[model samples]
Target chain A: MARVIRTIGWTLIVLGVVVLLYVVYLLWFTGFETQREQRDLADEWSLTVPDDPIDHDREVDREAPEEDDEPVDVGDAYAALWFERDGEPIVSDDVIYVVEGVDLPTLRRGPGHYPESDRPGGEGNFAIAGHRTTYGAPFWSLDVLEPGDTIHVIDRQGREWVYAYVEQRIVQPTELWVVGEDPLGSGAPMITLTTCHPRYSDAQRLIAWGELLDDPIESTAEGGERDEIPES
Target chain B: MADNDAPNGDDPGPRADPDGGGRGGIPRWVKAILLLVVIAVAVVVLFTTVFPWVEERTQDPTMGTMLTPWLAYLRF
Candidate 1:
């Protein structure tokens, strides 16, 4: 009986240690690793790109649906986000910094852009997702985001597009429409960010939607190019 | 019946085993083989069952598509 009790006790101890390590990895270690990845991406983006404008005007090609096109590959990053903090108290850093594409590997790096969502500087809803309570918990303070907080997405050409947080709502994990809605009919440019809700629980989704502060203007196709990135 | 066979009616030794076959328990080599077989089956199941499921989920960048909800139950 004592042997059996000892075995069960040891198993529990091992399990407890494993859980603690996992939390540590999710909270601290993963954040540190992602910081390294972001720095590498920043370095890569600063180099190996040239100045050539790429046209993105959808008006000229009305017959073809531009919105349905796939987002950039998981490997290629387009923008790094910088949140304005002094103007807002909720921001943990000046940069809540996220790389392009919200795939698992990409998200492990930082907040990921939902490729199906509208691109930055577009007429429809542009969406991004981040981990709410783990793996750096980029959006852990999402509950703190309210009206007036600014989320910035920098274009490949060094032009920064700004969006202002309007409101945030908590919805169940089953609430899929928030990310699927088409705002093109409204003729307003919007940005939506979704993360796990209630912190440490996946029972809900915390969605913070924002409208573009910058007026959508004609692009010279520069946002698509691999070059022309400013180091600063 | 085996309890009556103990030398001094004190230490039951191998006879105390429930099976009463004089085989106290599974042999050490048999236990090792069982462990190896269990590990091999687990690896096979993971590759054949879990690996593909994960691949399909990651193809889309959306949050719903990326999450393996069942795996989130432990939150560990």
Candidate 2:
């Protein structure tokens, strides 16, 4: 009887240890995979996006999609997402490439854009989903983001859309309204970032909302040859 | 019966263990610890290697995929 009890106890201990190791993998090892994917995606983005300097005098119709705003294939990287704090880059040289789909596999590579949502700087909500605790954990500090913080997105044509943080909401996972076309109900150009809430749990979602600012810097394409354009 | 010849008494010397001396005459507690260590190593391999290989095939990035039906609830 004593031996049987000891065996049972050891079995439980082994199970506990397994759970701990999985948590470790989720928190640490998974980031390596995401970082590698992001590096490749970043390289592709740099090569594809024009290097032309910001054309300050160019006119941009915020409500209309540009001719170059071709739909990005799902799982493919097309734009670079950057966070700014105090007018400086937040993640320090890390430019997270935003993939075209919010599916699990695409998100594992980096932040994913919701297919039904509007494009960056478009007249509706441009929603994105990202991981908070695994697979690069790009939104790991999302909950701490305060209003007025800025998020910048650079597209293939070198158009930079700047968005200012507005509010945050913790909602049930079933709350699909957060990603709706007019989440703010004003038909304004906005951004919504969704991630698992409360760290280490997916019971709910944490949403960070932002509105597109008017100062969009446009970089012109020079002869469609990236090599000919000088990098600033 | 042979019981009368051997005499039933508390003789703590080396005796035949029907459960098999696979225990190698080691103490029960020591064996239990060794068993736990082996299990821990297996668990590490399963998480660090086996599960990853399975994930690669399934293209399922979440760990919940391994647990399946039971862990389907763990998905976002």
The top-ranked prediction according to TM-score is 2
On residues A1-232, what C-alpha lDDT tens digit does candidate 1 reach at each position?
5534754575566556655665565557767777777677666666632332122211222123445434555756566565553343344563544566776667777788777777765667878888865556778777665455666665444445667766677765555667765522445678888887566665566777777764423212212223221111
| RMSD values, in order shown | 10.8, 11.3
Superposed by TM-score, candidate 2 places the C-alpha of residue A151 at a distance from the truth, in angstroms, of 1.5
Instruction: Provide the lowest-lDDT 10-residue window in model 1 chain A.
Output: A53-62
- TM-score (C-alpha, index-matched) for candidate 1: 0.63
Residue-level lDDT of model 2, residues A1-232, one tens digit each, is 5556866787778777877777677678989999999888877776776774233234443544467688789988866787766655554246678898877768888988888888888778888888887888888777655554677876667777787777777765656788888887866788998877667766557787888888743322122222221111
Off by over 4 Å in 1: A1-20, A48-71, A85-90, A181-186, A215-232, B1-76
What is candidate 2's CA lDDT for residue B66?
36
Q: What DockQ score does model 1 reach against the true complex?
A: 0.11
Q: Model 2: clashing residue pairs?
A: none
Cα lDDT of all candidates, in order?
A: 0.58, 0.68
**What's the fnat for candidate 2, on a 0 to 1 scale?**
0.09
Task: Give candidate 2 misplaced runs (Cα > 4 Å).
Answer: A1-9, A52-67, A91-93, A216-232, B1-76
